[model samples]
Target: MTELAVMGPKESEFVDRMGLYYERLGGTRTMGRMYAWLMICDPPHQSLTELAGELGVSKTAISTVARQLESGGMIERVPAPGRQHHYRIVSGGWAQVLQVRLVEVRNLVETLDLGLAVLDDSLPEQRARLEETRDFFAFSNLDGMELLKRWEEHRKNQD
Candidate 1:
């Protein structure tokens, strides 16, 4: 298997494109660039200066991206005694990110449930539509919860 540090041409192209896609999804281009760099860079935790140099960006840009990642729980800030703060991808980061997104999913499910209840007092035609919506969201919530449980188990195993 190829080492993580060495991205083949195809992988490099994919990573670059993914960075752009993430940018379109409300993340800054620099944040996406930093994530791509972290995925392929050697030694995991890169200094801001190193990432800035590698990505051909300024240190301030790298610093901002690092803070964004840190707050989003995608990366951790490591401050060793007398050393500058360094950033590393969080262990089981994807699972945690998914968990956070699931909160929104749960809220959606709850909103649907409320709609279903409101429709129960309406005409039969409206009730059918609302019930259908409720069923879908209920099933979705159960599935999301199952996936979350699995992720928790997987994270525990990794620990």
Candidate 2:
């Protein structure tokens, strides 16, 4: 009969939407669940067993998502010596993570650009919409990169 930190209704909804977003962007549902658990759980760090239990996923899925998050710079694995490894979400300036996702969106825009071109002006309206979307992504990507660079510089100067 113990209570742990849990997401409220709004946060739960947010996590659910984020899970769908990640799934749509080619990540597995388990990966999304892992992220959700990390965001809501107290301490922000968990072991494979804990994550698996919370996410109701197999240990293998937890391991895979942990590796993926680490590689994507969204999380980092902690060394625990003779114990199982633990992971924590990347802290400080969530902006960097946003920038990474924007880059991925920018890549999608490039692919969409190709598809629209192949459509060959047959659907001018659709082409215009796609072009606008592409332009927005390109601009956002550039802005994100610049912001992250400035943040890095500021952090260095603080030292």
Candidate 3:
């Protein structure tokens, strides 16, 4: 295994900010830090041991978060020479994440549609609220899909 470079103060601060951002988005700080580090880490890939050492966490913790990230399509496991696992960010990882979110948005739209169906006609205000929320999500879902398509095209062009 190669020696991992020590993180400088600025890099560490950026990792911490990413951690907080991920935490706010319902993910662990460790996961966010690891993700941030991976984005800029040397050689573009790191093993569990390397990640644990860099983040001051246990290998088990890193492994757990790695699995979550892999399943979520943000990162992917790569084959290395030894038994230790390695991971790196995917090319369209953010787009994959957005795709997952759009699915959730679609689900919410369906739920709102159900709510509108069961809602009483007498409650005009409640119906209006549901209608507005549903409309917003529906439009957002459409826009998000278009955005993802455009992003993919742009990425392909870059490549």
Candidate 4:
């Protein structure tokens, strides 16, 4: 296991890439970098101070970003009996991320359904496009749920 602070070129590259990837998905760059660091860091968990030092960010920033990650269900905080608070990636974190995205999909579908109700179905042009979009959203939600269920089975088998 490689300590994030001591990562060589290749591991550092991975952290950088993960940071960019998450940023592209609309997360703050700092939080994305911290999340990448936690995902592959040695010893599994790191205190906020440790993370701040490793990422060269402020402790306040680490605390804020760590709480954001926690709230999003991407990471878990480990409470030590007498030591500082620590953090690690949640098990199947990517799956949890996808599940969170599925909620957004549901929201969009509901909004589209309401729009469809208000639109005149007698006109083929406007209603057709909205109908197509609603269909796509519904399909995506269905497929996403099935994929998660399949992932759960795969994870269970591995365990």
Which is the leading candidate under TM-score?
Answer: 3
* Model 4, span 2-100: residue lDDT tens: 444566678678877878887898987788888888877887788998888887789999999999999988899998555689999987878988999
Stretches of candidate 3 off by over 4 Å are none
The better-scoring model by lDDT among 1 and 4 is 4
TM-score of each: 0.74, 0.59, 0.95, 0.90
Q: How many collisions between residues are there in candidate 3?
A: 0
Stretches of candidate 1 off by over 4 Å are 1-14, 80-83, 152-159
Ordered list by lDDT, greatest first: 3, 4, 2, 1
Candidate 4 Cα errors over 4 Å, as ranges = 1-5, 81-83
- In Å, residue 11's CA in model 3 sits off its true spot by 1.2
Model 4 residue 113 distance off true place after TM-score fit, in angstroms: 0.9
Candidate 4 is scored at a TM of 0.90
- Model 3 agreement with the true structure over 55-115: per-residue lDDT tens digits: 9999999999999999999999999987999999987888889999999999999999999
With a 3 Å backbone cut-off (N, CA, C), the pairs that clash in candidate 3 are none
Per-residue C-alpha lDDT of model 2 across residues 28-79, encoded as one tens digit per residue: 7777767877877886778898787766679998998899988877788876
Clashing pairs in 2: none
Score each candidate by Cα lDDT: 0.76, 0.78, 0.95, 0.87
- CA RMSD per model (angstroms): 4.5, 5.8, 1.2, 2.4
TM-score of 2: 0.59
lDDT score, residue 136, model 3?
A: 100
**Highest lDDT, which number?**
3
Candidate 4 lDDT: 0.87
